[model samples]
Target: MAYPYDSLLPQVTRPRTISPLPPSAPGEEAKDEEVEQVKWKRPAVVTPQAVHSKRALLEKEQEQTASSEMPRPSQGELFPAREQEEQHRQQVEEPEENGQNIKAEPQAELPEAQSDIMALKRKNKDDMRRVQEENLNQQRGDQQNQVSERVAATPLMKHPLPSCLLTNKDHVQAELQDSEASNKVREKRLEEEIKIIRDKANRLSQSLQKQVAIKKINLQGLQRKQLTVNEIMIMKRNRSPSVVNYLDSYLLGEELWLVLEYMDGGALSDVISETFLSEEQMAAISRECLRGLDFLHSNHIIHRDVKSDNILLRTDGSVKLADFGLSTQLTPEQNRRCTLAGTPWWMAPEVVTGQPYGPKVDIWSFGIVGIEMVEREPPYCNQSPASAQRLIATVGTPKLRHPKLLSALLRDFLSCCLQKDEEERWSAMELLQHPFVTSAKPASILSQLINSVKKRKKN
Candidate 1:
């Protein structure tokens, strides 16, 4: 309903506003008073920084009041004083242009100097402490490594399998069993191969002719050589014996298996038993025995059982060595064996000591044979084998003391031959050239005896 648009503007109406309720209750009045007091007490115009500072100062003050002791400030506090007092203090404390404080530059530099010194001391101490700790750690590591190495080196008893390994035992066993079966197959194949080789060897041996050429030997003239007790007795009966010589030869394989030689005479031992072997006799026998030993040794053969029983004498009183069954060929520079394989009575000290001995052992036995030839019995004759062994181990070297004997030469030679140490024993060749055996008269006598024995056989 527009009436007079130009005459009147649109009527404007005032909006109603709601008003807050007035405080009237006594409790509410008290709360409003508290809130008003808090607002009045708070600072009116505070910045964020000043407010934060004020809060911190209040908290500090509260903490100081609550604590039993309060810490003092690092810097001293300045105080407001009367004008005359301030003037006097300033004059006394401040440095004058020509005062000692101004002149004492070195003293003023002391604090800085002390701080630098303390810093260096602290650095050095820290370095030393660090080095010490590193060394201690290194030592500890070394100890641990040593302990672990020892543990690894020590053999351990059998142990139960680990739990995880035990769980897979069936699989492991299957693998091992397969390997064992393969080894069995390989062994069977090797055995078959060996059998084939053995069969081939047997077949080849059978197919091939093994012919042994037998030389025609004169059997009709071969005398049935026999050694008889009567012959031996007759040979002993004659002190000035007939000369008998033996052709040096070896024969093998007979029914009785006898080593036959034309008997010239019995051993010099038998003669020595009945009659005393004079110095000439002893020297002659010694030279002959040494010659035999030298010849045997030069052939690398050791007549290990060198004794009166083994040394046969011709009727001409010349000796011939026999019985090479106990002999062995010694290699050059190789020590003899420890087979405990010689006549117990003739064994060297080294043999009794249960050690490997060389051909020097024969020399030691030869010394015993020499004693037997001179005395007609073993040195420790009456004792049992055990007792003899004990005596030998202790002191049983043959000692001779004949007035007519070559004391210096014979005694020293026998001593060397009977040495307990194998290294010290004389070689057979060395014994052959010794003065007692090699003297011109003794050598000539031995040569005459040997030639007579040979001539008698020839006749």
Candidate 2:
């Protein structure tokens, strides 16, 4: 069958045929045919140049076959409708010049097929462009995800604090804590020291308050009274440790101010009322009272008002005789006083009976003070002054409420002081030597009792 493009192929010429030889022998004919076939199949002698030419021709043919088989652009891409029409016009015009009249056929299906192929090529180009772009975007997304994972895996790369700086900061914090603790300790110590100093200052103020006291007396009432003058003179003349010292006296208009040593423990009466004393403590007090009475009697002075109220005490337990307003001096010629000038309860029986008495009256009063210490009050304390004076004159001696409770030595000492006969009563000097008085503890021991009373009162 003839194709439409057959005219484009090269023309091949036919080879000449030889006439057959007449009537060859039947066997010889077969031999002659084989020889002819052999001669026809025999290879021709080939030179180097011919061999090279044949090799080059074979390579050329191979190249032509490859080019024909390879894919090519569609006819629509190679030639548009205008180019196809121009080619057709040239074929028609050149046909008579080539000495042959050839008719050109219109290819109706070629253009339609070329158009469909061109449409498919454009679609493929768009699809390939889209695929390339999508692949590139996917690769970029994968690279970004890998970078994020690396960053998350190693946190030290993001924010790092050096070990040296951290250690130094810890050291500084510890030092600050220690310094604050030390400062607190020092502040506490200073507060304690300040408290101690404040206590000492308070104690010194109290001590100063107890050093001196003033007594005010109206001068108009006692200006001409010899008793007041004698009392002041006697106080000034006495210089015993067991006696209160007189400082100075002042005359302010109608008032006379007598400055005297202040006893911080107040009066012995106050001490007995507030608390009970042991026998040893009472003995110590008796010794001090005896010392004062001895001093007074040795000086020829009679303390007619000797009683617990007239006895003063210091915080150190020193006892002294005070309030010498009822005291009088005795001469060798007149050694007795008949005047009734003492507390009824503590008055001597001879004085209350209107008999003459002397310094031994003070010894009798001291014995009553000893009873006051034990019983908290003297005998006949509930009676009136007149009734007590009557009792003292009628009764030979005042008896204790519970005399059996007293020790033998204490009872003997009281007996010596309370003897009805003035000659039988022991003097203050003789009483000082009594076992009850001699066994007395030191005066310093009484400070404990004084301080306890003060603390209890404060509470």
lDDT of each: 0.57, 0.77
Per-residue C-alpha lDDT of model 2 across residues 290-353, encoded as one tens digit per residue: 9999999999999899998888888877788998878898998998889988888998899988
Reference-based lDDT, residue 112, model 1: 38
**Residue-level error in angstroms, candidate 2, position 227:** 2.1
Estimate, for each residue in 1-459, the C-alpha lDDT of model 1 and write its tens digit.
Answer: 222222332242212242556868999985655444322222122234544665589679768775856665422234434544433322223132452233212222223323555556566556666667887999999999999999998879557889888779978999999999998997797667556644544454355432111111222323423322222332232222112212112222222212134434555555555555555666677767777777656656665677777776655455667555456666767746775656767778877777787677778888887677566687778887777777787774755646255466666767777887777678877876777777625333544454454555456
- Assess the local accuracy of residue 437 in candidate 2 as a C-alpha lDDT between 0 and 100: 91
In candidate 2 the C-alpha lDDT for residue 336 amounts to 87
Error of 1 at 84 (Å): 99
Could you tell me how far off, in angstroms, the CA of residue 454 lies in candidate 2 after the best superposition?
Answer: 3.0
Q: Total clashing residue pairs per candidate?
A: 1, 0
Judge candidate 1 at residue 20 and give its lDDT.
59
Q: What TM-score does candidate 1 reach?
A: 0.41
